[model samples]
Target: MAQLIRTPKQLGVVIRNAHARSGLTQQALADLVGTGQKTVSRIENGHDGTRMDTLFAIIAALDMDLQLGPRSKGGKDISEIF
Candidate 1:
């Protein structure tokens, strides 16, 4: 399934969910990405200052792929969930 992420909060939710699904703790994910647990916590909390490199590293550690494309007009809007 595909999800549309329009805000940092939404992105955080996705990352947190994916991390849960992967059965990895924030500390564990940090270990995999060679960062600190606090950094993972910040990213999962949607801290906007997160560096692109760290973001990519965390995503890769979670076995996730970041895709870019035109926003789908037919998919569920993230606002509905919040």
Candidate 2:
């Protein structure tokens, strides 16, 4: 399933849930990403701003892909330009 993440908090929640589903602890994910556990914790909590490189690393490590698309309209994908 694809989720449109419009906020950092949403991204945080997705990553946290994904980590759990993958059976990885904060420390384990940190080790995989070559970062600190505290950093992962902060990111999961959405309290600490994360670097783009780090965010991409985390996403990749979790076997997730990030996509960019045109803005949605009223809770639906914009399929018509007119």
Candidate 3:
């Protein structure tokens, strides 16, 4: 499946879902990413104020990849969904 997440909130949703799909608890993923469970919870809840390194670590821990393309064609591209 493919999800085009534009905002941090949507990215959080995708991470949460991916974590769920991986059958790992927040703490487990946190361990894999060398972070705390609370931090993972914060990320999943759409509080995206964390550092970019942490974000990338979370994404990598979940076996996910990021793809960036040219900006959307319209004023607001809601096509960015998880």
Candidate 4:
């Protein structure tokens, strides 16, 4: 099955969970990325309009990879094969 990201909020939830699983607090992540705790909180709460640099920093801090590709037509998507 394909995992679909419906909204920025949903993405935020995933980021938050991943961060927790990696044993890093929001403040610690913010410090690592040279951002403030409030910014991290906003991101965690699904606030869209975050800067690309901020997003990249968050992804790096979480030790996660960001992938972009076309959506699936019906059931399985080409992205799943990769």
Candidate 5:
């Protein structure tokens, strides 16, 4: 499922939800991410200081893909205009 994330907090919610869906505890996810549980907690809570590498690792751990595309405007995909 592609989620449109516009803010760090929104991203955090997505990650937290994905983590729950994967049935992994925070500590377990932390272990998989090679980070501390506290770090995972901070991430889940939308800490904006997270490093890109760590964020990517967490996304990978949850089997989630990060994608970049043209931003939709007025709830319409820009690609649709062409």
Candidate 6:
């Protein structure tokens, strides 16, 4: 699924929702991602800047895929042009 997360708040919502949907507690997900509960909380609350590797680990733990692409131009829909 392609999601347009333009801010930290949006990203936090996505992460929190994914974690909840995966039925994992903050601490549990943190453990799986080799981080601490506080870190997870911070990320979920959009407070701290999470490392890319840590973000990927969290995504993996939640069984989600993260893709990067350019934003749309001229009001066009964002699409993966790569």
lDDT of each: 0.87, 0.86, 0.85, 0.82, 0.89, 0.82
In the range 1-82, model 5's lDDT, one tens digit per residue, is 8987877788899999999999999999999989999988998888889989999999999998999998666647654343
- The sequence of per-residue lDDT tens digits that candidate 3 reaches over residues 62-81 is 88898887765565645633
1-82: candidate 4 lDDT, tens digit per residue: 2245657787788888888898988889999999999888888889988998998999888888887778556757565343
Per residue, candidate 1 scores C-alpha lDDT tens digits across 1-82 of: 6787877877898999999999999999999999999988888898788889999998998899999877556648656454
lDDT-wise, the better of 2 and 5 is 5
RMSD of each candidate?
Answer: 3.3, 4.7, 3.1, 5.2, 4.6, 4.4
The candidate, 1 or 6, that scores higher on lDDT is 1
What does the lDDT come to for candidate 5?
0.89
The candidate 3 region of ten consecutive residues with least summed lDDT is: 73-82
lDDT tens per residue, model 6, 1-82: 6687766667788999998888889999999989999988888888757898988888889888888777656564453221
Candidate 3 Cα RMSD after full superposition onto the native fold (Å) = 3.1
Order of candidate numbers by TM-score, starting with the best: 5, 2, 3, 1, 6, 4
Per-residue error for 2 in candidate 2, Å, reads 0.4
lDDT over C-alpha atoms for residue 75 of model 3: 54
lDDT of 2 by residue, 18-72 (tens): 9999999999999999999999988888765789899999999999999999865
Q: Is candidate 3 or candidate 4 better by TM-score?
A: 3
Score residue 22 of candidate 2 by CA lDDT.
93
Number of clashing residue pairs in every model? 0, 0, 0, 0, 0, 0
After TM-score superposition, the amount by which residue 42's alpha carbon in candidate 5 deviates from its true location, in angstroms, is 1.0
Q: How many Å off is the CA of 20 in candidate 5?
A: 0.4
Report the poorest 10 consecutive residues by lDDT, candidate 5.
Answer: 73-82
